[model samples]
Target: MGPRKITAHGDKGAEVQGKIRRLGSWRRAAAMIVAVGTVWAGTVMPASADTDLPEYLTKMRAPEMWKVADGTGITVAVIDSGVKDLPELEGRVLPGVSFMEPPVSRPEEKYPVHDDFEGHGTSMIAAIVGDGSGGGPHGLAPGAKVMPIRTSIGSPMAFGAIGEAGKGVRYAADNGAKIINLSIGGWWSLDRIGPAIEYAQSKGVLVFVGMGNDGSKMSNPIAALPGAFGVGAVDINGEPLESSSNGSATDFAAFGGKVPIRCKKNTAWCMQDGGTSYATSLASASAALVWSAHPDWTANQVARVLLQTAGGPVDGAKRNDWVGYGIARPSKVLIDRQGDPGAPDTDPLASPTPQPSTPSADPAAAVPPQAESTAAESDRSWKWPALGAAVAVILGLGITGILKRRRR
Candidate 1:
């Protein structure tokens, strides 16, 4: 059957549609994950779609934040279908690797590491670093560079997709990528991808992963993996998008509802889309802004400040499953300079004691004794239970089926 259109409406009077690809299972482990590549393509009816900036940017106060730091000298690796160059991404997209099989039977022009077959990778890149030239979607960190790493995740080759994605993660860590974005979701075994995630963490690279679009049914297991920050999606009203998966693993939330994305069927126009995929990108870009401004800080330090400055839990808890610490607000760090950098080697989400890693040489990298105690008490109080819950979900559940995008 041919692809069907899915029209969705949002507060901005913007509408979008695209073909949907249902989730497929991998028999080896009876595992399946929601693919972030679904693009609901159809007619867009916004009155001024061409000239308007995404509402999230305005909400984020992106212009004011950019004046402080634009993610200069930071590189984010996007692992997905691949990234096609867009005018908004000129001179910023880096040469990246791909793990998909060679299209030997078809014309070589039809496939390349940057082909962007699903337009998923390109949208992600644009969300992080697009320059907004010619009315394209402007990224949160326009000065950042994107390292494209293409891999097949939702195709007939589903069985090997995780392995390919693992290699991409490792490559990103080894190649100086400060941040890695994995927007794919599913309930695959940790044995397949855990090592690479750990490797990235060990290399001091922050990995931002999507919580999936499964809503309350489940979050992506990958987000539950240790050392990975699971990101959920929130609407402009600071409420969780009904489609964004949530659980103990959700570490953060971002503006994902009706997010401006490069159109899959047409590159000339932008479409409003929603998912944890775009939320993850925005979270990663927020990290870039912090990292670029404090280039001397270790990954742990950058993460610490973000956690400290994020919009705190609405319920006044240290952290919650729905929105993690809270919606990521880099402005707190960039504009107000409110968050404490903490110890260079200590993980804010983990114990307060210094991790067994090299300490920062910067004179200002030391943590205050009081700060360490406070953070330790607060994090231990909340993080361990959530971690246990996430681990349990990973081993106990065997969910499968279509992960449809939610429309309001």
Candidate 2:
């Protein structure tokens, strides 16, 4: 099997390529992954209707019993296209600033800034913190509020620049946002945004980001933001979304369903896995729920607990390249209530020893960082898209004789 951007060390030293793709407004960017099974794609969207939330949540539950307290009083800042006021999220999302360069008018075309043209930002916010109501997509923490910070230059990201988002994350943290969800990435091989994450961590803020959709089959940046949790997405059947990127950088996994935005009112035509961006939001929202229950935990402590208690436990001792720490289960943190949430000054993910990968070299993802399939509808793009492109040719790390690791 050919390798996509991200590959796992497989049996007999062969790289098992996993398939993946990305669907969006500008161009439908896609990737390839060679795995034991399955294929993937990018970009597909869904509606904010009530019918799809339960099944997704049930899949996330993974037979685990995590009951995180309602995440009230916490604010997760979303830095992407922008969020609109939908019925399901009415009054739940708060208004924030736009780092969208020369900026546009909202409410209508720009100013007041909550228009989700790309649809990537809208899906990410809903996945992380939407309050399940009247048949909606239930959030990882349904009660936590969101802060929208639009930064997309539009559609896909610039190949090697930070765009406008680097500034936005810092602004959100500086202005009192406790959680920042960055569901986007770029391709610049530069160490551009470090201090922002450190600065946010200092404020006791938790940052969640997506590993690039490219790495699900390529050797590139797998969302490795410092002090930020790198998240990967999986499909509804409790399987890894073939396109979900992975690496030592990945902190955890979440249900980023194969979606088709089945509209409830008018405006139909939606389906796609919100990609890795939505996955990161789910990680942020899950952390929000765990933190809301404790209210006294540090960001590190929250992350550590997630790693220790992930559902669908893995096989060996090494951290997974694809599903880092397995699927995150907030229920594990709340139901049994593990972890000490460390002092406000301590970092929970602070390793006693150095990990195998370098921290600052993440290759940056494309704009609207991640994608997801939506609503009650699911897409089989895993098989459809680019069948003719000479995509992946599995490299590095043998796929055979791979060992699994034990988790907390």
Candidate 3:
């Protein structure tokens, strides 16, 4: 298999570039943006090929697990650029909102609600609940419905990126989203979105966030926020990718590197595009599989089961910063009936320390506390190649310079 071509809408290239720049250091920004490009290196397959499935599913034994639960009745909210109306997602996308607009608005009459500005959101949605129609890749939870919440990370029209993200999370939680998947990440502190995250957790909605692709240069604050399930990327060998961020905040790992995905604008399927963003989607879908099977379970119970059944080091002393509890094995949790669901009111990731009786003077002090992970920072070289000079004009020279400097 070889790389396949993926086209983006003409207007979106600038938007993506601008978004990347605002994300932080040019190097980290480029890593996140280019992570999607890796799909071009994957085996190009036709949209009509129905028999094929992504390797990660096969490795996880999704078919064996599907007999018990196919994620029916669960709604996973995808908070990203936007989801595209593709054949794979037909009838599965529920009404969603675009928080980029003030007061938020439904899709206008001119465009579909899921009309993706960049291919990233569509790819994340497909990875969570694509039905595998038209030969597209099947999601881990094909029976799950997705609520697409369109949010712009760096657009001029975007409110503060963090504020919009917080609004999106609150909206999804209020609208019956059982699992919220945030495939976008940055270095911002949790102060901006802490309240929204707390609100979702209070409502018993599970939230999953990407650990970012900055290697060890920086960590995503969203991942560090209490109640957010931070997910990192791993290769087929079950090893964490060098590009995956490491920290106490990352709780799980999933296939994010060299993975196949349905492209945003192009008809062809992409092979190798991925990062922690994709990993977050898979983790969210995995939760859907479990939550759908046991609708009565609270968000904490579901999260506990996942942590209990995750694969990796059995020894309590081993370093797991990069991979966390290891690869997500929803099949193990479902088919093997692993882990106790525990009390509905108790949170698995809750801190044992007592809280202060009084409020702090600093508003930022409201952010919840987090227990740190023991995972060591990665010392490996950046794995992805830089987008060449020809592509720089499209992505911007300043962005390219940042990536080059980071590589050095």
The whole-model lDDT of each prediction reads: 0.65, 0.52, 0.63
> Arrange candidates by TM-score, highest first: which order?
1, 3, 2
TM-scores, each model vs. reference: 0.75, 0.68, 0.73
Q: Candidate 1: where is the Cα deviation over 4 Å?
A: 1-32, 45-52, 102-111, 264-270, 352-408
lDDT of 3 by residue, 307-336 (tens): 766765333322255656556788867887
Question: Least lDDT summed over 10 consecutive residues: which range in candidate 3?
Answer: 399-408
User: What ordering of candidates by lDDT runs from best to worst?
Assistant: 1, 3, 2
lDDT of 3: 0.63
Which lDDT tens digits does candidate 2 get at residues 129-162? 6555544456666667888887642332222113
Candidate 2 local distance difference test against the native: 0.52
| lDDT (10s digit) by residue, model 1, range 56-147 | 78777788898989999999999887887777789889999887654346535334677775577888888899876666677899899999
* Ranking 1 against 3 by TM-score, winner: 1
- Which one is best on TM-score? 1
* Cα lDDT, model 1, residue 15: 12
Off by over 4 Å in 2: 1-52, 61-68, 103-111, 132-136, 153-161, 188-191, 215-222, 260-269, 353-408
